[model samples]
Target chain A: MLMIIRLMIAAMFILTTPWSGLAEVQDESALDIQVREIAKTLRCTVCQTENIWESGAPLAQQMRGVVRDRLKLGHSPEDIKEYFLSRYGDYIMMQPPAHGVNWLLWLGPFILLLGGGLLLYKEVIGWVRRTPANPTAPPPPLDEQARQRLERELES
Target chain B: MNKGTQLTLVLVLLGLFYLFYEGLWGNPRHIPTVLIGTDAPMVEGPDVETGEIISLEQFKGKVVLLNFWASWCYECKVEHESVLELHRLFKDNPNFVMLGVNYQDKLPDAQQYLKEYGTTFAHMRDLKGQLAIDYGVYGVPETFVIDQQGKIRYKYVGPVTGHMYTKITQEIIAPLLKGQPVSTAS
Candidate 1:
């Protein structure tokens, strides 16, 4: 009976170990997903054209750690983002906030595109209007008499 | 296009080009800091050598020079001597305090660096880098001058050496210590 009881206890321990490991992994992955989501939005201050999530720079790593800690602390994603924004200003964000002078950055390209398209369209329309409809009818396709005269002139 | 429209178009294009040029080539170090005149974040960390807690709150009503650096950073090594000298120069002032922040460095390596390069001021280890983020630090070798009222008066990114050393000592810190207003321009 003691041997049977001991075997049962050992079996229970073995069975529970994998379940505990799985639980820990699931918890970590949930936290990791949150960290990645937040880190993706922050620009790596030390690296150009890379967000903190993708940057290998130590600073970016630290920023990711900060995001994870804040998330663990029950701070919302917006709060974490706001914390970074307040610290590093608009530059810290991957997408600059559409306010203040940053409005120019957000809208400048589209405004330029619209204005350029309008100008190009106007110029194209003007060119179409200025062009003769049939290009003077190709100079009346060179009448037979004109063709003969041209040939005679060339021969002379 | 009419003359007025053409002129406007040229002017807009020129403006856009200028902005693009500045964005591409401008020094990231010169990117203006928004922390100026704002309350400095009160932070704390363990001292690198002593393992004792060093809190910035204790230094309230004093001018604090917070220099963030790391062992792996080249510029930090370059400015090490100048940094120590800056501390020596201002250490005599009762109202002046300087603290070194060891950022993103390993414990053994940090201690080894300090042993070789030497440090006069107390350096606190940025354990999880929370201290650095709280201060809005972009990278190592960045310095900040917090006034008596805990307002960050000035911030400079990069090695505080040569002309910068002179500027911080004379133009910024000196004036602030003398109860005179200093320029917040980076």
Candidate 2:
């Protein structure tokens, strides 16, 4: 009877015990979600082209860890981004902040396109004005006599 | 194009060319740190030799020189002598304290490094690299000087030797220790 009770107890323990690792991974864990969201926005200082989330560099990995740790400490995502900006300056941002001289970077291309288009338009109008246009009267269709004359010249 | 318009276009072209040149030619190592003149972060870690926990808070009101170094960094080895000399120059001052941050290395390797290259000041082990990140340190052999007000007075990225050593000693640390103004100009 004791053996049967022990067997029942063992079965109950096995069935009821939670798998901590599997639970952490399978469920959309809040911390992992938060880390990914924040990491995706931050440029990896060591690898300038890649964000911390996508980069495999050890520094990037440590940065991801920092993001995770800070999130755990109740820092908002903006606060975390501000933290990095404070450390690495404007260069750290993947998108340069729209401030000061950086305004040129944001708007320079559009301004250039508009300016170039205007310049080209003016130049083309000038060329059209300067050059002679086709005569108003269409040239008479090539006469049979002219065609024959051209053919004779070719033969000669 | 009219004279004014042509001048504007030329100026715009020059500006764009300058930006392109900077993007291509600027040194990747020379990241401008924003922490200068800001409050220095208090860092804590285990003593590299003794394994006892050391906190930067205890060194408040002193001119703290935090040098970040690693076991494998060649520049750290190169600057090691000059770093020691700098410490020796100011170690007698009651207002000055120098802390060595052993960064991103194994415990045994760090202890071996301190053993091989004599260390006079307390060295802290940055186990998870949090301490280095706290100071925005991307590489070894970076140095920072914090003033009595706990603001980061100066930071140098590379090895401190030659003219750099002279500059840090006379122009930076000495002035801060005396509570005089030092230029934080970039």
Task: Give per-residue lDDT, candidate 1, residue A74.
Answer: 94
Candidate 1 lDDT over residue span B129-149, tens digit each: 888888888788899999999
lDDT of 2 by residue, B1-186 (tens): 787986787677667767756754555457567889999999899999888999999999999999999998999999999999999999999999999999878889888998999989999988787888788877788999999999998899889999989999999999999999998743
- Give the residue spans of candidate 1 off by over 4 A: A1-26, A122-156, B17-27
Write down the TM-score for model 2: 0.79
**Residue B124 CA displacement from its true place in model 1, Å:** 1.8
What is the two-chain DockQ of model 2? 0.28
- Span of 10 residues, lowest total lDDT, candidate 1 chain A: A134-143
lDDT of 2 by residue, A6-122 (tens): 999998877766565567665548788889988888777767467889999777888889998898788999999998888877766777799997788778778777777777787
Which segments of candidate 2 are over 4 A away from where they belong?
A1-23, A26-28, A112-156, B3-8, B20-25
CAPRI category for model 1: acceptable
Give the candidate number with the greatest TM-score.
Answer: 1
Question: Residue by residue across A29-89, what tens digits does model 1's lDDT show?
Answer: 9999989988999889877768999999877888998898889999999999999988988
lDDT of 2: 0.86
